[model samples]
Target: MEPLAFSFDQPLFQLASLPITAGHLVAAAALLMALVAIAAGRRARSLRIDERDGQISALLAAQTELQGRIATMAEVFGARQAELNQTLSQRIDGMTHRIGASISEQTKATHENLRRLQERLAVIDSAQNNIQALAKDMAGLQNILSNKQTRGAFGQSRMEAIVADGLPISAYTFQATLPNGARPDCIIRMPNGQPPLVIDAKFPLESWNSMRDAPDADRRQQAAQAFRRDMEVHVRDIASKYLLPGETQETAFLFVPSESIFAEIHEHFEALVQKAHRQRIVIVSPSLLLLSIQVIQAILKDARMREQAHLIQGEVIRLMEDLSRLDERVRKLQGHFAMAQKDVDEILISSNKLTRRGARIETLEMEATAPPGPSEKGERAVDNRMGQLKLRVVDED
Candidate 1:
């Protein structure tokens, strides 16, 4: 059945005025009963809409309370914002100050470091100049060593320099004659002042230089043979010239070629070394020479030290004489000083005695000027103590 739309102001009930026959009256009654059921269903729907409206009003009141809470929270947030801003400003200023202070300190430290570095550089510059001058002098000295005429002086100066670095120069003497009547280059004294040990520095350098200048292997080999032969002859000659019995304590030293040449001789010629050793001639290279000079320098230094002891003993005797004279003079001065002190003491005694006499005279004068006391005014008619200053009845009174 289809239901009709209902309006609240208009009544859903309707009355039908009808004229009907006995058979149509029942059909009309059934139609009225169907309209009553539709009206009841519409009324129930309206009751449900009223219940929903009441619930909506309660929801609106809750929304109003929540808005008031939001407004209070906003005010509190505004005050907190102001406090946070103040604290943030102070922190920013402090941080800025700390950053600035750190920057300033770093800059100052850097400046001080730079200044110190610059000062050190200046010192280094001065030291560099001194080093340069020393190097130049050394180069000039080395240049002088290349000449044959100055070679002896070179060898002597170099050897002396080496010895003087650790050993004293007084240990050796210039040009000593061996027992064989041959003069060696230099000799150092023994501790007992015996004949010094012999060493010869003169060697054939031109021939070695000639061998160095050879171009081919054949020429070089020939030069090598010549150089070896010359060395053998040199060794024999040195032994014959310097090695003699009762001349020196040790075998004579034959100073040879440079270190390289000495190395070559040892590498190539063992036979020559044995022959030379048999002849009592030991070839010394530069390194070996250094050791020899040290030994020789020690021996001579000990001898000189012994002589210096005698010299010192003589000086001590002279000093004792001077000390005796000095003591006599000191005694005379002490006697004079004592006399002066005694005179000063006597003068002080005389001054003290004069002061005591002046005090006594002042007392006598004061008593004469003062008037007589009332107790004994006319009793002293004899005037016995006219010039005397009286105090009590003890003395001449």
Candidate 2:
């Protein structure tokens, strides 16, 4: 027997060529229904796959756009961050520089202030030392001024210094004995044969001090009165002792060494000054004495200039005579130079004539030695003219 073969299109078992039974029909139907179901299922699966692909494509496109946007945002953020960092750095640098400059300025100012403070401290220390020294000097002066004779000597010395500073040594004399046998502190000789001016340096300082240091008004008044009386007595004594008939000046000086005392007398005792003036005794401070000495020096200088006037005139006259002599000598020398120049001009003319004559003689000799020219007569005539020029040159010499 042959092997049985099964085919989907063919009947399972064919009875003859006629074939076909109900089973076959039913199998074929079942197979067709299965095929239809499979087709439907495939169609449904294809539709579902298409829908999912569309959804996936849409999601990918959206993701790609989102990625592009994110990239752009990141770039923008980076650029902004770089700019912000640069800006921040610049601001930080600026702030740091400003802070450094401010700190430096403050430090310099602090140092300067400290230096100035140190200088001020040094100045204060120096000032304090000077004040201490001045206090010691004041104490010494007070001690010296306590004694009357020493005070008088001090006044005399001060007056002498002023007088010596203002006037020449010959113009003034110190401790000079007057014609009346009274020795004054200084004597200033007046010019033009005027009487000698006497200066007395002693003054009533005790009463003035008492008046200045009185306790109350009554005491001060009494002290002022005593000071006035003492000054009046001094003025009277100076006038009587120093003022001579023809030897001393009518106005004598009572020198007050202390400017303060002099000022006090002028301010508070005008009447006393007037009284002294009436007695021909003028009150003078050290400064006033210096001024008076200067005036006297001026007068003496004027007198000296007057005395030397004739000598100056004589010297000027001698200078004029000398100038006149120098002018005369200069004129005579100029005349001699003119005569010498004329002689030199004449010698130059003679030398020129001699040079011309010698040149002619040389030309004649050259012509005579040459072969006789076409005109020997002309050559002989040239020689004769050269001889004549030589004779004229000798005559000029």
Candidate 3:
């Protein structure tokens, strides 16, 4: 009655109440193969993901360790840098201080050297001024020495100065007139009523100058002969004028102003010196005259000492008498001091006893109640103790 239905899935058999077909079996087998392929792919993907995760963790750990090491190295380097900076600063400061000190020392040394140089320059300047003054004096002296009368005056003046310096005003007289109306340059009064010693400062130096100025040996010889004759004549004159037996010393001094001239005469003219000495005329240079003055002064001093010998002896006797009286008075004073010392010792003993009694009284306590009455024997013992306590002062004088 119905139209026949053509179908691709035809039921081959019925199992229980379900119809089974070939198309259904084929679809089930294809689905199972697809599920197996999908499961295997998922397992391989999970294994790859686990391996990548392990590698990432290892890299992160390594990076963290490297960062820690870098931080530690940075800290060490910073500390080293700080130490280096401090060392450099200290060295720089030390160098700066040393350099400053060196500069300061150098400045002080320079100033000291400059001061020394200035002092030396000042001394040189003073020396230059003194040299100028000395040159002027030399010129003046040459002018004075050129004239005969001025030269004689100069010699006399120099001799006067020497005598005045050596002898007292009362001991010597300048331009003293003798009994024979002969005037001498100086006269030194001798002690003990002896005749005064005479000094003559006049000397003839013209022939000496001529001899020194001679151009030839013959002229020099002639000038030297004249000089000798002049010297002999001057010596004779001095002897006749100054060597008066009753008025002046038997020996008279002929003063030569120039030491060089005196030396020259002594060296070249031995005969003249002997002649002068024989005639009681002693040729003396300034130094020799000074020595003679010293000798005369010593003689005068000895004579004065001899004259006062009696007075000195009398004074010594008086001093000895005074010293004996002083010794006797000192002995009496010592006896008096011994008595005073004994009195002082006794006073000290009384003071010590009073001090001990005062201490004993201070230690005793005051009581309001009266002490018990004493027996007759106890009263006698108390009286003896009180008598022992009484102070006795001794007088030594």
| Candidate that scores best on lDDT | 2
What is the Å distance of residue 76 in model 3 from its true position?
A: 13
Better of 1 and 2 by lDDT: 2
TM-score of each: 0.46, 0.64, 0.67
334 in model 2: Cα distance from truth in Å? 5.8
| Residue-wise C-alpha lDDT for candidate 2, range 73-168, written one tens digit per residue | 999999999999999999999999999999999999999999999999999999999999999989988887888888888889999999989888
lDDT of 3 by residue, 242-334 (tens): 888888889998999989999999999998899999998899999999999899889989999999999999999999999999999999999
RMSD after Cα superposition, model 2: 10.1
lDDT per residue for candidate 1 within 1-397, as digits (tens), equals 8999544444334447643443354455666666776677667666766766777777777777777777788778877888888899899999999999999999999999999999999989989998999899778866764676676666656554554564555556657666567877767656674766777776656567567789998988888788778877887777777666677645877676368878876777788778878887787887888887777666666767887998989999999999999999999999999999999999999998778767866775666554556656443632435534453323522
What TM-score does candidate 2 get on C-alpha atoms? 0.64
Candidate 2, position 259, lDDT: 87
Give candidate 2 regions above 4 Å deviation: 1-70, 85-133, 329-397
Candidates' lDDT values, in order? 0.72, 0.88, 0.87
